[model samples]
Target: MVDQQWTGVRRRVVALGARADSGQVFGSLGHRWVLEDPLSAAELAELEAQTGARLPEDYRDFLTGVGAGGAGPAYGLFPVRRVQGRWRWEGDGAELADPSMLARPFPGHGPDPESLAALLAERPEEEDFDASEEFDDAVEAWDERWEAVMFAPERTAGAIVISHVGCAQREWLIVSGAHRGTIWSDCRADDTDLAPLVDDDGRPLTFAGWYTTWLEAAELTSRQ
Candidate 1:
C-alpha cells in the first residue's frame, strides 16, 4: 500500500466549435488534449501497482516515450503532446467546453427517482458512502471524463466515470463521449480478470463504444 506521488504531468483541455468531419458545429464545443511530463518515474511504477491494471500500449507509450518528460503531440480530441501548459478547453474544429452547460446531471436525463429511492432504501455502510463521495468529487474535477454516461451524457458523464473508476466492487463502462453511446470497460468479468474489451473470439479492440452488458450499477453497493 505504498502511496507514491506521481509527477504533476499536465493534460490540457482546449475548446472547439464544429465537428471536423461535418465542418459545421456553431453552437457546439470540443477540446484538444495534451499530456505533459516532468513526472516522477517512481510515480508511474506506483500507479501500475496501485491500479493493478495495466495501461494499453498506446496509452503507456504516450506516457513513457519521448514525451516522458516533455510535451508531445496531439491525437484527435486528445493530443498526445502539446506546446503549452493549459489544456485546450474551447471551441475548435471539434467542440468546446462549458462548465455551466454541464452543471446539471445529464442533458435530457434527470434524476432517476426510482434509482434514488432504491439507493435510499438500502442504507450503505460508511465505507460505501466514502467511496461514492470520492467518486463524485473526482468526476467533478474533470469535464472530458463524461465519456462514461449514456443518459444526458455531457452533463453526467464525468460523474459516471468517477463512479466507475472509484468503484471498489463493481463493473464499469466507458464511452467515446457524453452522448456517443459506446462501451469502455467491464471491471467485473466472469471472475476478477480486468482486461480491455474483446470480440466473440477474444480479439482486442481499440474501443467498444458504450454498453450495459456488465453488472448492474446500483447493485454494486448492495451486493456486499
Candidate 2:
C-alpha cells in the first residue's frame, strides 16, 4: 500500500510546478520542478541491506510513494541512485555522507563549546599582521584547525545530506539515534555548528513536516 503521508504530495507538487514561476524561488532552477522516479520495494530493500540501516519511515515512504528526489527546498532534494550496485546520494558535497557509517548514532553536537570558542578567538585577522603574505599563511593555518573541528566526519554520522542552499550550506536528515527523522541545518561553512531545523514553536521538524511545510510555502508562492 502506498504510504498515506505522501498521498497528495506529488500531485500538489506537480500542480505547483504548472503554475509557479520557478525563477521566483531560490534554487528552483537546479531541479526545474522535476521529480525523479520512485524506488521499488526491491531497490529500497537492497539499499537498506547495503547500508545496514533502515531509513526513517517518512523518507522511506517518500522513496516509494513520491520521487526519490527533485523539486524540494533549497537546491532541491539530493537524488539517491544505485551505481554499480552501490546506492549513494548525488549532489554537491553529497559524498560527505558515508554509506558505511549510516547505522552509527549521529552526534547531536559538534565540538566542545569551550574549545570552539577558543579556536574562534584565535582566528587570524589580516589586519593584525604587518605583511599580506604572513597574514595569508596565518589564516590558512587557522582555517585548517577550524575545518578539523567543524568538518570532522564523525560529527555527521547516521545523517544524509538532503539539500544544499549554496555557499557550502546544506541540510541533513538524521536517520539514526534519538533525532532520527528530523532535519538539521548545516552552516559550518559560515563558522557555525549544526542545528536542528525547528518550526515556529521550536519543535524539531520531521521529514514529513519539513517537506510538507516547504510544499505548502511553494504553493503559496506560486499562487501569488
Candidate 3:
C-alpha cells in the first residue's frame, strides 16, 4: 500500500518542473527540480543505525518513497549520503548537526532573554571607535561572546539541519524529542532564537506538511 503521506508527491514535483516557467520561480534554478533517487530499505536501515535514532516517519517515508533530498523548500532539501562508510547530510551548515548527539533532547529555550538583550545592546558600532583596528578588535570580542551564548552545541541536540534558506539561515528537523517530526526555523544568524515553523492555524509544521506546502506553491507559481 502506498503511504498516503507522500502519495503523488514525486509525480507532482515532476509535473511542476515540466512547466516552461518553473525555472522562473525563486530558488528553482538551484535544485532544477531534480530529486535524488529514493533510498532502499537497506540504505534506510543503515542510516538509522548510524544516527542511532529512527528518523521521523514522515521524513523517513519521503526518503524511501519520494527522494532522499532535492527540489525542496528554499534552495532544496539537503541530501544525505554515505562517505567513508558513514551517513551524513550534506549542505551549507549541515555539519552543525552532530549525529552522535541525535538522541538527546533539544533545548527548550535559548539564552535568557534579558542577558541576550544586554549582549545585543553591547554590540560594537564602527563609528564608536576612532581606529578601524580598535573597532575590529571590539567586534571580534563581542562575536565570541555572542557565539558562546547563542550557538552552543547543546542548543540543537536531537535535531538535524535539513535545509538552508540562504544568508546563513537554515531549518532543522527534530528527531528524538518531544518535538520530533516537527520543523524549526533557525535565524540565529540574525540574532533571533530558533522557533517552530507553524501553519495557518498556528500549529507546528511536520515534515510532510512543510514539503507539501512548498510543492503546492511551486506548482501554482509554475502554472501562472
lDDT (0 to 1) per candidate: 0.29, 0.90, 0.91
Give a tens-digit lDDT track for model 2, residues 1-224. 66797998988878777773746766788878888899999999999999998999999999989999998998899999999979999999899889888999998988889999999999988789999999999999999989887888899999999999899999999998889999999999899999999998999999889998988888777767
Off by over 4 Å in 1: 1-29, 38-40, 66-204, 207-224
True lDDT of residue 211, candidate 3:
94
Model 3 CA lDDT for position 98: 92
- Clash numbers, per candidate: 34, 0, 0
Pairwise lDDT winner, candidates 1 and 2: 2
Model 1 Cα lDDT, one tens digit per residue, 9-104: 232111111213221221111212222442245545554443333433333443453233212111122222222532122212112222233222
Q: Which 10-residue window of candidate 2 scores lowest in summed lDDT?
A: 17-26
Highest TM-score, which number? 2
| Deviation of model 1 at 46, angstroms | 1.5
Q: Using TM-score as the measure, what is the rank order of every candidate, best first?
A: 2, 3, 1
